[model samples]
Target: MSVTKALEGAVGWLTLNRPDKLNSMTRDMVETMAAALKAWRDDAAVRVVVLTGTGRAFCAGADLKAGNGAAAPQPGEKDSLDVIVDFFDTLRNFPKPVIVAVNGLALAGGMEVVLSCDIVLAAESARLGDAHSNFGVFPGGGGAALLPRKVPDNVARYLLFTGDSLTAAEMKTYGLVNEVLPDAELTDRARALAEKLAGKSPLVLARMKRVAANACDKTTADAIRHELLELRDHKRSYDIQEGLRAFAEKRKPEFKGY
Candidate 1:
């Protein structure tokens, strides 16, 4: 598979797999990512996931050069969650924390994938953008929704309108980048973050994720009420009691996903 491979050890590493093409995604790669992420979502060992590239670029975008078989999508195409459907949607709503470790350029659909990640740490030389607009399509992935949530409206609009790439420093200023490191340190930094998150209680993280996701869509009164309900439900989960006991006893909590 041009998408590269494997799901193991609580850390699923998805390398775009086609470095020669700047690791641009092929239909196969997209499919592979969707399936792999889904598998990880429910895996007990997996607490954090990482996406990266194998070579010069993280992923320059969808592979235009992919030979005709499954076929390449048109520049301005849309379907009712067609073709790339599973690929984009899976990344967006994945319950577990996903991290994008950009070693180089991440453009168009590739950049869209990164935007869906819970966190992003980039190499100092990395280039990230939504160049699909330049090719005449609105971002088919979650860029339209994800970008605005991560940065200022004006900044998101600027990139959407111009289809320009942002440097690591510039991207950091806009707040999408959680951390930045030298090229050689990209994997290390990503692994560090993944390990830290993986050590947390998955049940607590899940509930926290629900609250965070919900708060963005509700009023303060509704949010508070929702949170109370969440806590009420949370009490039934073992992780909550473990967390509390751990806090009181001054020891690490052993989270059993309840």
Candidate 2:
């Protein structure tokens, strides 16, 4: 399998499994991951998700040597690039939080994956960059578009133009990474963070994600209005009432996720 799926408590773990290839994504890997995300989307048992890879790399990007896993498209059929784009759309729109654990190298399409995710935790040894320029290939993913939104314009330009890698610590300083840990501690720390998120009200978390995403491109006034509308709708949810009741009883809220 090019991708592996596992359930740990309320966290769903999706691992890129082709370490021999630096975990580069193939069309099959993208499809498999999309299917898993769809399955976990509505699964009440799964409240959080973690995406990572095996071996020395998180993902080096698409396998250029394999023609990026492209196959001839039949009439009315989508090709590899379409498949890759759709998978990224699914990931970005996932209701539950998706955390990325960067264990090593993440370049090109791999860096785009990090952009789509909700949070990123990296190992001290991890390195990330846009290597597409080096090979005269333009990024078809979020690398060209979303990179600037995540970091300063200058930083994005540096990565895009130079095709040089940045240390996990350096990326953190640029706001691309949330936390960095020792390589030996990366997996455990990521799992612990996922477990912590799994304890929250799934409904609340989903709403928060939706509202935040919606607000990102809006003006302050529009964003406030949007947030207010969402809050108004959320006031009627069972989770809200349960949370208040639990607070009154001085106990942990047993959120049912509405």
Best by the lDDT measure: 2
lDDT (10s digit) by residue, model 2, range 1-258 = 999999998999999999999999888889899899999997999999999999999999998877744568998998888888889999999999999999999999999999999999999999999999999999988898999999999999999999999999999999999999999999999999999999888999998999898887999999999889889989999999998999999999888898
Instruction: Report per-prediction Cα RMSD to one decimal.
Output: 3.4, 1.1
How much is 167 displaced in model 1, in angstroms? 0.6
Question: How accurate locally is residue 33 in candidate 2, as Cα lDDT from 0 to 100?
Answer: 92
Q: Write model 1 residue lDDT over 1-258, tens digit each, in one string.
A: 566555545677777767778987776677778888888887887777899987879988876556334444577864324658777778878888888999999888888888888889999999888887887766678778778888899999888889999998899998988888999999988887888887788877777777887798899999999889988998998898999999999999988877
Query: Model 1's lDDT to the true fold?
Result: 0.81
Per-model TM-score, in order, reads 0.90, 0.97
lDDT of the candidates, in the order given: 0.81, 0.93
TM match of model 2 to true structure: 0.97
Clashing pairs in 1: none
Name model 1 segments beyond 4 Å from true: 67-81
